[model samples]
Target chain A: MTLKKATAYRLSDNSKALLIFYFVIFAVMLSFILRTTLFTSSNYGTLGGLDASSMIFIFVVSLIFAESFKMLQQNGCSRKTIFLSFVYSTIILAVVMAVVDSLTAMLMDIITSNYESGFFQIYQARYQSMRSAQHFFEGLLWYVTAYVMMGAIGFFITNLYYRMGKLLKVLVSVGVPVFFVIILPILSNLTGGAIYEGIKNFFDFAWGFSHGFNPYFSMVSASIFSVILGGLAFLLIRRAVPKQ
Target chain B: MKGIEIRNLSKSYGEVVALKDINLKFGGDKIYGLLGRNGAGKTTLLNIISNRLFPDSGEVLVDGETAIENDSAQRKIYMMGESNFYPEGMTIRQAFRWSQRFYPSFDRNLALSLVEKFSLGLDKKMKSLSTGYNSIFKAIVALATKVPYTLLDEPVLGLDANHRDLLYKSLLESYQEHPRTIVISTHLIDEVANIIEDIVIIDQGEILRNQSSEEMLKQGYTVYGTAAAIDNYIADKEVIGFDNLGGLKTAYILGEVDNIIPPELEVTKLNLQKLFVVLTNRRALK
Candidate 1:
C-alpha cells in the first residue's frame, strides 16, 4: 500500500492508538531539547552536550513503537505491506529525530560557546581531543543510525517471539544476547583480541562517519555493515510466513 | 458455490499421525458441525483448509486452487480457532481494530454492537478479561469479519450456559442475515445440533461420517424396550451403540426404522449429538 493510503490505524483503532502513542513518546524527548536554554540556530552544524541517557531515551521510545510491527504480522497483514510501512515510518521518525537533535545541539553549541568563551579558549589550549572536533559531526550521524539499528533489534525479537513457541522463544531471546555479552570477553582473551579489535575498529569508524570527521574508507565500511545487517532484517520480514 | 476439497491429506506430529489420508469436501451455505474427539484432528484439518498450517502430504483445494499460502483463497476463509494471538496489553477495542485492518470485510459497527451486547468493556485489556469473556471477544471478532467461509474451532469453550445460549441465538441470526458457509468445530453437540445443517464427524485421524444432518438423523435412531425386544427389533439394522439398565435397553441403530420397528419397540429420534457420539465412539474402537 502507498504511504498516502497506508494509515496504520485504519485497519483497527487500536493500531492507530499504538502508532500515536509511539510518536508522542518519541516527540517528548525532542520537546525537552527544544525547551532547553542552550538551544540556538547559530550552532546548527555542531554536536552539543546531550548525554547518552537522552539518546537512550529516544532509542527506548523507538523500541516500544516497534511492537506494532509484530502486531501487523500477527493480524495476517501481508509481508510486503507490513515491512514497507514499517520502513517508511521508521525513516520518517528518524528524519524527525535527526532534525530535532540537530537543532538542540546547535542551540547548545551557540549558548555554550558564547557563555564560556574564555574558559573554552583556556581549555582548548590544554585539550588534546579538540584536534578532532570534526568527529563530533560524524558522531551525530552515528547516533541516528545506532538508534534505528537498536529499534530494528527490538522489532526482530518481537517477530521471533511471534513465530516460536514459549520455551524456545524465551531461550533464544534471552540466550543469544546474554551469550554474546558473556562470551565476547573470554573470546577476546583467547583470540588475542583479534575479533574484539575488529569489532571496535568497526564502531570507531562508524563514530567517525557520524561526526563527519572520519576518512572516506571508514564511512564506506560503516555503510557496508549497515547495509548487510539491515538487508538481513528486510529478508527476515520478506520470507516470514504468517506464524502464530 | 464451491467447497474445500481435500485429497490424501496427511499430517503427523513426530511419530503420531494427526490426520491420516483424510479426504472430504464441504460446500455451499450450510453450517457443518465438525465433531471429533480431542485428538481426532479437527483443528488440524480446519487449520490446513484456512492456510494456518501446512500439511506433510497431499493437497487441499478451495474452489479448485491450492490452499497452502494462497492469499486469495485465504481471503475467502477465516479461521478463529482455540489460539487467541492477541498481543499482551491490547484492549478489547484494540483487538477489534487490528482485526478490521487485516480483514477487509470486517464490520466495526457490528463488532462494537456485539461488544456492548456481550457486556464486554472496550477498554478492558484482553489479558485482564476472564476466559469466557476472552472467548466472547473472539467470537465477536469472528462474527464481524463476515468472511464467506468462517471456521470456528471450539467457539464457546469457556462460556457459561446463558452466554452459550445467547451466542447460539446470535450465530443463527448472523448466519441468516448473511447466508454464508460456516464450519463450526465444537464439543457441545446438543447445543449446535438444531442449527447445523451438515455434519462431518472425524475419528482417529479419519472422517467417520460426512452427510446432511437430516439424512444422518433419519438413519440414526434409538430403539427402546426390553433388552431382548430392542435387540430383536434392531437385529436387521446396524447398531452403533446400546445401553441397558436392569432389563430396559436402548439401542442406537444406524439407518431408518420406518416399517420394520416392532410395535412393542419404542423408537425415539436421534439428534446430531447422539449420532455424532455413537459414530465417533464406534470409529475410535475400530
Candidate 2:
C-alpha cells in the first residue's frame, strides 16, 4: 500500500512535467497553424518531433535524485521502495508519453495533411510495412523503448554521481568525456577501425536493422538495457545515506 | 511485541565510533526522552533506527517486522531529522499535500491547525523559512503524522523560548490525544523533564542510563556546604560532579540520600538535567 502511494506520487511528479511539456508544444504548434492559415502562399515547416522532445524531457526529469530521494525517504520509505517507485515511474511515464505523442501525431496529420517528420517518417526505410496504422503501432513501441532507455541512462548517471565522493565524482565527470571523445577515437584508429566496426555491428544486431527489419530485437534490447542500468542504480543507492 | 528492538547495533565512521554495540527497546505508546551531550551518539542511534544510516552490525525490528527495507514497517514510523529533508522550492502547503499521500494516517486538518497556531506561512517556500520556522514546520508535520512510533531528533533545535514552550504544550496535547511511542533525542533535559515519562541517557557511544524519569532522578542529589564539609560528606559516597567557589562547595552525588545530614550541609533533590550532566561528563567517559 505504501509502495502504491509512492509510485503514484512519482508518476504524478512526471505527469505534471509532461503537462508543461504539452502546453509548450501546443503553443508552438498553434503558431505554425496561424502562419499556415494567414499566409496561404507561404510554406509552413513541419512540426512533428514531439516524440524526440518528450524523450529528452523524460531523460532530464529522471536526472533528479536529491529531491525525489529526500521526499520519499522523508515519508518513511526505504531505499527499496524509492528505487522501485523510480523504475515504475519511468515505465509509466514512457508509456504515457508514447501514447500521447502517437495520438497527437496522428491527429495533427488528419487536421493538416502536411504533417511529417515523425519517427515513422524519419525511419521509414528501417520499417518494412508502409501502412499508416502499422507505422503508428511500430512508432509507439519504438518511442516507448527509446524513452525507457533514455530514462534509465539518465537515472543511472545521477545515481552514480550521488554515490560518489567529491574526488571520484570529478574524476568520473572528466574521465567519461575524455575517454569517449579522445581515447576511444585514438584506440579505434590504432585498431584499424575495428573498434568502430564492432560497435556499429553491436547496434545493428540490437536494433534488428540488419536482417529482417525486425523491431523486436530493439524492444528486447531496450528492456535489457533498462534492467541492467536499473540494477546498477539499485546497487549504488542500496547503502546510500543522506548528506547533512 | 510492539516496539523498536535493537540488538548489538554498532556503527562507525572511519576512526570515529558513532555507536558501539547498543542494545535497547523502545516499547509501547510512551514518551521517551533520549538525553545526551553533543556527539554522544544520540543522533546516530536515531538515524540507525530510521534506516537513514546502515549499522556496521546488528538489526532493528519495528514491532515484529524488520525495519531494514520493509515498507510496511517503515510506514508505521517517521523521524523528523535535524536537517531539512524537504525540497527547498516546495511550499508548506505542497508538503502537507504530499504528506497526506505518503502517510495514510496523516491528519491534514491537524497540520493546518498547528500551522495557524505557529503562524507559519503555508505558501512560503521551505528555503524562505527562518531556522525557527523551519523547525516549527517540520515539527507540526511530524505531530500530524500520528504514526505508531515517532522519533524526533533535535525537535526544538532553533525555536525561541515562546515557541519552545508552545511546542512542548502541543507535544503533550498530541500525546494525550492519541497515545503513541514518541522518542525525543535532545540535550535540553530540563525543558522536557515534565514532558517525557521514560528517560534514556547515552554518552560516548554507549547507553549510560535507561529508566523512568522519577526513578533516575531519585538516584542522585546535590549537597551544598563549606568545601571541607562537602568534601568530607561526598568522600564515602559516589560523586559525579563538583563545583566550588572560595570556601563553599557543591558536590553532585549519585545514591540514596541519608535521613540524618550535617546541620551546615544542605541537600537538594537531583533534577534530570543535573543527573544527565554528571552522567555524561567527560570524566565518566572511557
DockQ of the two-chain complex in candidate 1 = 0.24
RMSD of each: 6.3, 2.6
TM-score, model 2 to reference: 0.93
- Candidate 2, residue B243: how far the Cα is off, in Å: 6.5
lDDT of 1 by residue, B95-123 (tens): 77667766778889988888878999999
Best by DockQ: 2
The fnat scores of all predictions, in order, read: 0.16, 0.88
Which regions of candidate 2 fall more than 4 Å away from where they truly are?
A: A126-131, B223-251, B261-267, B282-286
What lDDT does the true structure give each of the candidates?
Answer: 0.68, 0.86
Per-prediction backbone clash count? 13, 0
Ten-residue stretch with the least lDDT total in model 1 chain A: A114-123
Write the residue-wise lDDT of candidate 2 on B1-286 in tens digits: 8899989999899999988899999988899999888888999998888888889999999998888878888888889999999989889999999988888788998899999999998999999999899999999989999999999999998999999999999999998999999999987888999999898888788888899988988998889999999878877898877888999998888889999999999998776776777666654654
Deviation in Å, model 1, residue A219 alpha carbon: 6.7
TM-score versus the correct structure, for each prediction = 0.76, 0.93
Which CAPRI quality tier does the interface of model 1 achieve?
acceptable
